[model samples]
Target: MGRRKPNETMRLLVATFIGIVLGFFLGVSFPTLSLTKLNLPSSLFPSIDLTYIEDKYSGLSTQALLNAWSSLQGKDGSAAEINEFNESRIWVPTNPRGAERLPPGIIASESDFYLRRLWGSPDEDLKMRPKYLVTFTVGYEQRKNIDAAIKKFSEDFTIVLFHYDGRTTEWDEYEWSKNAIHISAPKQTKWWYAKRFLHPDIVAAYDYIFIWDEDLGVEHFNAEKYLRLVKKHGLEISQPGLEPNNGLTWQMTKRREDSEVHKDTEEKPGWCSDPHLPPCAGFVEIMAPVFSRNAWRCVWHMIQNDLVHGWGLDFALRRCVEPAHEKIGVVDAQWIVHQSVPSLGNQVRPKALIALGLSFIDMVFTSLSFKSCQGKAESGKAPWEGVRERCRKEWRMFQERMSSAERAYYVSLGIDPPNSTTAR
Candidate 1:
């Protein structure tokens, strides 16, 4: 086939987009539309059914959308509620003791429930559950990732921002519309926040909990459909299928637009050979994993305090879900791109002087980089060699620590631990 003219191609693209928009409106308007007749591709009318949209999208009912449309004509005259929780809550005087007035017998500075949030509050009272409570661990150094997440999820889901840099002052510039919860800490990985702040029991009110990296491209992801696919296929823990050209590391994650969802894929030999394990089994990279409420309860306890990078968790996820090959998987119906932005670790540490840029101090810290530089020169290894070696060492250490803990428990019970030679 020959390529079309530029003007013709643009017209066709615009027309297709208009059709999609029309289809969405039609689905909402025509209540008679049958779920049985909507057998289109996963990329097409996958959401012609209400089950997926109801899970995410805050379950905005057809009547609600219709009401919003009707209100567009200046009919209802009542402002639609936005940030309802905050609106309903009452604010008290900041200086409790100095206040000239106090309500009846109410204690000063005790007008609202605030401090218990640290213990992980449930959202069950909200009437509708968000498919996932999106948690983004950020340093506030780069605004792009955080901004994208807030923009996409603020309207529909509960967003929890974990600030590692502890810079609450800089957050005002971002217009969150008071829809997100902002928590700041000195420095802690996303896993640490999950283990401490987002206890699974507390978050059981939500259907799924998305523990994800800050940097991602959701251009092709449909959160509602992603939830539907995971629930439909019984995936306890899963991640969106990643774009192949997005610097992804495994074949199982690479998105296949033709498939609605994929649990396994053909991978190169040596990636994992069990066939029951990943890059094939019920496992996905932690870069962006969505956990079912029950599964998150198991995963939460598995996170170790000192293993900050979480290098070894993916391989061991099977321990949390039985028949792991069937329960842990990836979604291909709609996918996301891994920005692969190194926003998490080693942000300021230098491995070599030659790689340095001009500092405002007007000096290159060659002396500070001396040991690493000399070590690399003598060993004929790249700076990445050190990182890879360190990752391997940490992974080994984490495994041994887990095994030793189990062994100690067995010893205390007057019995030997399972044979280490057979597995570890």
Candidate 2:
């Protein structure tokens, strides 16, 4: 073939360079853009499939997408690994002191009637019964009660106690019980305490992991029946603690418009019939959620968030549970009384201010991006209408909610609400 003309060669080179520059800029700027839209020619970008490219770069570190998987992997021995247990059931007892607070009558009733019926009746279809009961004790005062409860239940199931406290010197106390596993919660945030103490190794000991807050008392609680329900429903992440008064309590009202619409059809089943609505199957309060080994493993991978204190539980739950497309079942059959009632004390005011400030920042960022993108599209500078509309709606909601949350937090903190000038 004859050599290309000098002008032709220059034009080809310039076009290739421009394409590369555009791809890099688009990838960096609109990091959330779906990879399918890249529409990269297969021949030129043969090594990278645009569809799969998003997974590889979905939470690219520099883009601030917060790669949860990456964060988990960065921790020592904390890479997301799946381990399964052969036994279908695991029993969990809250630490002794927490259990002691439970009504003795209620506990006895569950142990005699509910626990036995479930464990005794073998499912002919599944041909297995839940065998192990795991209990965790944190403070010294609760250990005695926990140990006694475990001993009482030892005949029906394998009772295991997981103890954690850096100050404890009696490591040998648990040596007698083959069922018990002792671990320490290093002086760290409650978030890390759960992660490290509730490590995958301990979780791998059974198929179904029951994470019970110590204060829960089983009253008409049938462990076998609950497991059967979990198995029947094929629940990956399940909760059997407190049920919401109404579904409206669970509704994420402040999400972006598209998100709200999508949630209506996808996440939630019903439309907002009334402007003042309650949540349908409201958010899970994480007090006594049970995870199939799979769910625990998936959630475990997301525990290493930047929020060191316990404040990020809800945020992490939303991120992990929502993305997995798993439903959190609030079991109304049995209710666990939460002993340590959450209160907004001295630090609450500061935390509220911080949350409001962050919300404001998020709103501003989302709004500016949406408005500019929408304006460009309207001005015929961009061709993608769907992208622009979605961005605009999301930003608008963010702006509105951020302002509202800031005001509410300030009022709760006994401070003057920020004016538009302060907001700026």
The candidate that achieves the highest TM-score relative to the unseen native structure: 1
Q: Global lDDT of each model?
A: 0.65, 0.43
* C-alpha-based local distance difference test score of model 1: 0.65
Candidate 2: global Cα-lDDT? 0.43
Where does candidate 1 clash, by residue pair? 282-328
Residues 1-424, model 2: lDDT tens digits: 9999999999999999999999878766755767587676678877776865554445344344334334445455332231121121122234233343354445532121112334544543333333444444344445554444344333334333334335354534754354344445542333444575566555464566565444334443555656666666555555554322311123332222221011111234443332222122223434455666666667777554433333223323433444332344444443433333111111122223344454543332322222112122345533223333444454354445546766999999999995521111
Sequence-dependent TM-score of model 2: 0.38
Q: Which candidate is the best by lDDT?
A: 1
Error of 2 at 27 (Å): 42
TM-score, prediction 1: 0.57
